[model samples]
Each structure stands twice: as C-alpha cells, then as structure tokens.
Target: MQRDYFDRVHFWGRISSVTALAVMLGIPLSISLHFGIWPQAAGVLNGLLKIIPMFWSIAVIEVLTYAPLLGAGGTYLSFVTGNISNLKLPCAINAMQNAKVSPSSEEGEVISTIAVASSSITTTLIIAVGVLAFSPLLPVITAEDSAIAPAFKQVVPALFGALGAGYFSKHFKISLVPIAAGVLILLVFPALPVGTLIPVTVIISLLGAHLSYKHTQKKEKKRQNQA
Candidate 1:
C-alpha cells in the first residue's frame, strides 16, 4: 500500500510537472507570436551566455538540496511555485514537527505537501491582493526614505535567520563545521559572486555534515562499547 501510494504520487507529479513546463515555455512563445517580434539571435545567445552559467549551476544544486526535504509531491509544487528555502521549506519543517513525523517517512511527505500547498495558496492570494492595490502601495514602498523599505529588504534574511537558528541549534554537529567554513571563505574570498557563493556553501556544508555524522557515530559506538 505504501509503495502504491508513492507510485501514484510520483506518477501525478510527473504529469503536473510536465504540464507546468509546457505552460511556462508557451508563455514566451505566445508573447513573441502576438507581438510578431523576435529577439536577435546574437542578443539572445549573449543573454543566455551571461545567465546560463550561474543559473544552471544553481538550478542543479537547488534540486539536489531541496528534493529530499520536499519529497515528491511537495518538490513538484515548490519547483513550480519557486521560493522553496525561504517559504516552503520552513513551513514544511514546522508542519512535520507539529505532526511528530520524520521527513524521511510517508507521513512527513503528506504533511510537507500540505504545508507547502497551503503556503502556495496563501502566497498566491496575497500576491493577487497586492496586485490589486499595487498602485497605491508602490510609491510608498519605493520611496527613498520610506520607513517600510528596510523591512522589505530584510524579509529574506529574517526568514532564513529564524529557521536556520532553530535547525542549527538542534543539529549543531552537522551545521557547525560548514557554517565555520562559510565564515572563513567569506572573509578570505570576499569577492565571490552570489551565484558562486550559494553552490559553494551547499557543497561545503554537505561535506562537513557527512564527516561530522561519521565522527558522531564513531564516538557513540565507542561510548557504547565502554559502557
């Protein structure tokens, strides 16, 4: 029954994902057709050359990092909707925690999907409302001296800081070495671009976590033998 459930979930995930891809691709094509305008081949190639290196690498890394946390269903929805780490991940973690489920389990998958989907819905509604009121809100938010401008700039960091602190507090062993590595790298190589920094941090963090886990297991086993 569990296997069948996952099979169905994966099957539908593929279908919906493919459909979403088609729609996204179709939008650009439809706009080009309607406007009877096409970008110059050289310009298009130049643009891709500028963006593809960074964006593609980050895309691959994001998939690797997020797929496990999100599971099949939530992964599909999060990829389509975007904003995984900042929004979906924290929300899903909180949901799974509340439900007392490990993220590696089926119950975790279901609850994470529920959390991510609910977040997606709420985000969509908020965006729609924002759009409706954007004309009035825009000037106030964009003004150079706007009181709320700093809040907007700080949202992502605030969200990440809160979530990261909570998780790192719980699993400091896995996170400590990587975080230290991050600080050292930033200090030593302060000029690393945003694109390079992200994937580099992820790679370093995973390696550190893996080594830490092994050391922890060894210490625990040694303690058990001594006892």
Candidate 2:
C-alpha cells in the first residue's frame, strides 16, 4: 500500500508539474505572439524569460499550499486510474471466476470516492480564486491594441458555447434550460455589474441543472408507469 501510494503521488506530481510548466510557457508565448511584443524569431525566448518568474512564483505558492493541492491532484489521479482499471473489467471478471479475490474491492471504491471529492473541492476552489485574481492581468498580457483586446474577450464566450454545445449533444433533452439561461444572462449583462456576472452565471447554471434533473426524473417516472 505504501509503495502504491508513493507511485501514485510521484506520477501525479510529475503530471501536474509538467502541465503547469507547459501552461506557464504556452500562455506567455501566445500572448507575446498575439501582441507582437517581439519578432517571431525571438518571441519564444522572450516569452520564456518573462514567464519563468511567474511560474516560479506559482510553484512556490503551490508548495506552500501542498496539502490542499495534493489532496486534489490525488483525487483526479485516483479517478483516472479507477476508470482505466474498470475498462479491464471483463478480463478481471473472467480471472475472478477462478481467483480467490476480486480486483474491484470495497476499499478501492472507498478510496477513489474520497479522493475524487477531496480533490474536486480543493482544485475547484483554487482555480476559481486564481482565475478571478488573474483576470485583470490577462488583458495586459494579451492586448495588442484596443481592437485586439476586445477580440480576445470573445474567446471565453466562444469556448463556453462550444462546451455547452458538446454537453447538449450528449444530453439533448436537457439542453434547453442552459440555452435559455445563457440567453437571459446575455440579455441582462449590459445592465449588470461585472462583479455580479460570475455569481449570476453560476446561479443560472445551477437552476438549469436542477430543472434538467427534475425533467429527467418526471420523464423516467412516466415511462415506468407506461410500462
């Protein structure tokens, strides 16, 4: 168990470290390119120099908050591992028929569940705070001219729309609430303060999700009665 824990810790630590580095490097490079801060040939080197200190600062902060970060990283790692392990379910079942113990045990289930919850809570809080705090700096980094800055602002909404579309494609019937909620938010956004937008968006999404759940439950019950 200790060995397995160590392996998982090392694996996820490396993964997060690499991901953070790539993001730190990529964002500054992209911003520099967007803003024409350097000639294309020198952009990467300049961006690297500019971003290294910022990345180091973030690393230091994460190390100081290692407890929460590790809890979250471990949760995600366990989830991914569990998913991969489950994919081998058919073979595992076949082996289990002749074996003394099953590969999928109660303890594994408990561990995965706990890891997922803890990781999710910590990671979400960290990301939410980070984004809020860093939002102002984004324009500074990415802005080339006033025109370009406004264009960059469209990226977030476009990305969100694509995500919403993917979600709707997977669950078509439940999509309308989110669509309507988004429309309402956009309609009211001009009058709303920027500070209120995030909370409003959250409320709308939550209400949409609740409505979708109730709708699905009602449909399921109707089908059951019909049967």
Candidate 3:
C-alpha cells in the first residue's frame, strides 16, 4: 500500500515552510509597524498575524507536501523523454493518490493549489481588513496621519525592492535583462489595462530566464572545450 504524500513531508520541509511564511509576512508587517501605521490597528493586525502560523501549519501539512515528491517523477520523465506534455500526468496522479483519503477529495489537488495561492491572498486581505477596520481608531492611538499611512502602504513595494536588490547584488549583470524587460512592460502598461501587466511581466521574466540559462550552457561548453 502506498503511503499518502500529504503525510510524508519531512519534518524539515514543515519547518522550512513555516520559516518561509513567517519571513514573507513578518518583513512587511515589521516595516509597516516601524512606520507607525501599525499602532492604529495593532490589536487587530497583531491578532491576525499571530493566526498565520497556525494556518500555515494546516496548509503545509495538508497541501504543498505532495507537489514536490510525486511531481518530481513526472518532471524527470518529461526531461528524459523530451515530452513536456506528460508533466501534468504525474502531478495529476499524485493528486488523485493523495485525494483518496483526503477529507475533501471532491476538491482534489486544485483545492490544494488554491489553498496555497490563498495563503498569499489571505495575508494581503488580512492586512487590508485590519487597516479598514481600524482606520477610525487611528485618532485614538496616534497624534496625526503624518507619513506613516503612506509608508505602510509602501510596504509591499519596499519588501519586493529589497528582495530584487538582494537578487541583483548576488547575480549582477545576469539581472539586467529582466530589469530591462520590466522597464519596457512598465512603459507600455499605461496604455493597457492593469491586468495585462501581470501576464506581460511573467512572459518577460521567463524570457530572461531562458536567455540566462542558454548563456550559462554556452559558457559551460566553452569551458569544456578549453579543457
């Protein structure tokens, strides 16, 4: 009998997922609080943030664990067989296998994917709700609006900028292609609905990845020929 993949994530993976979720949420929250906007909604925001660890525990245990292990077999087959179409088969098989005992098997792996996606969405919604719910209470907690509210709103971009800076610092010139592509997208984005930005950004990023991967392969071949 096959053991359920959801039950099989190593202890370390749970720890990693917990750490990732904390790091993801904590940085933005910390930045917002430091800017003083948090005090206004401190009670609600703190309560919501505190609950995330528990939520993450459930998501990691019930959802994301299978995608890596069972999906790996499919990925390997796709690579060796040169048939990328078969990639989903393994993921589907794993999902079905796991679903047999899952409480909501009717929802299946799509539900798991949505659960993982919802984690990010839920975090954003929690912050938005906290701000909206506590806006009236701000006067009681603070002297005035000042720059704190704007700074709090800036947390998402600031967090992303810090991440991008870190990546660029490590990768250097390799990051330039994506940076250029992003600039191009931004330039054209004003003419298009905001929804188009995401797909364009994704395509540009993938193109950058492909170029970088090809460059690395070529460099490796050159080094091998020199030796």
Across residues 1-227, which tens digit of lDDT does each residue of candidate 1 receive?
29998999889999999999999999989999999999899999998999898789788988888888888889999999887777888899878877988899989999999999999999988888887979687887768799888888889888778878877888877787667777788899988764456667778888887888899899999999999
Q: Could you tally the backbone clashes for each prediction?
A: 0, 1, 0
**Ranking, lDDT, top scorer first:** 1, 2, 3
Q: Could you say which candidate leads in TM-score?
A: 1
Residue pairs with clashing backbones, model 3: none
Task: Give lDDT tens digits, candidate 3, residues 1-227.
Answer: 12354334334345655676687689879998888665557777788798797766654442333334333332222222221222232334434444543323434534334333344355567668868998887655543566566676675577557546655776676677766776777776657643334345545666777888899999999999999
TM per prediction: 0.86, 0.33, 0.40
Q: lDDT of all the models against the reference?
A: 0.85, 0.53, 0.52
1 or 2: which has the higher lDDT?
1
Clashing pairs in 1: none
lDDT of 3: 0.52
What stretches of model 3 exceed 4 Å from their correct place? 1-3, 6-135, 138-147, 191-195
Cα shift from native, residue 66, model 1 (Å): 1.2
